[model samples]
Target: MERDIGDLTIEIDRTLCIGSGSCVGLASETFEIDEQNLVRFQDETPDIDPERLKEACAVCPVDALRVYDGDEQIVP
Candidate 1:
């Protein structure tokens, strides 16, 4: 879906994240691997593509990636 929100928000369930790095690979500007090898947000306001974010969420090995718009609408 095409969205035009103020900004994008991404959430990762650390408990469910398997460190597969798919999200990081897809949206490196928004996602990254912490020292613990867990998925974490790279910055508070990182540049991200809505469609690529959705792709990252879709390819998450454990469904741990969630992307939301400024209106809190889930994108994938």
Candidate 2:
């Protein structure tokens, strides 16, 4: 994906994430756990379904998820 939404990006703060699987359950194709069991980006900049992505963000229990657009803007 070309980050069509500007600097569109998603970041998981390992420190804040509690392995709740909310992000994974919501967007499995875009988020996953590595061999070390840490959540990692399936795509540094995912080719996302905007509405679904937003839902994933909203459902994250710890607010560990962040999505940024081209100008580093948050999309609702």
Candidate 3:
């Protein structure tokens, strides 16, 4: 599933995720790791600080997540 938070759009590639928990750690209100160890958003439009969202995306060791702020990429 894809989620939009402010100008940022977030998507998690479950197949590529390693259950790092980085997103949940940085923005607990916005993200969580399910029992399957996949990243799941709290909602379709999670309520979280933009800076914290970007920070979480930046820390993912694997490129399983993508967050875009407009046309610019917040995560690789």
TM-score for each predicted model, relative to the true structure: 0.72, 0.68, 0.85
Summarize candidate 2's per-residue lDDT along 1-76 as a digit string, tens digits.
1223233565567777677777788888777777766666675654678778767866878777777765574633
Clashing pairs in 3: none
Global lDDT of each candidate: 0.70, 0.67, 0.82
Candidates sorted by lDDT, descending order? 3, 1, 2
Residue pairs in clash, model 1: none
- Give the winner by TM-score: 3
Model 2 lDDT on a 0 to 1 scale: 0.67
Candidate 1 vs candidate 3, lDDT winner? 3
Inter-residue clash pairs, candidate 2: 5-70, 6-70, 7-69, 7-70
Instruction: Give the alpha carbon lDDT tens digit for every residue of 1-76 in model 1.
Output: 2222236655667888789998878877767789889887765534566677778767887878766766574734
lDDT of 3: 0.82
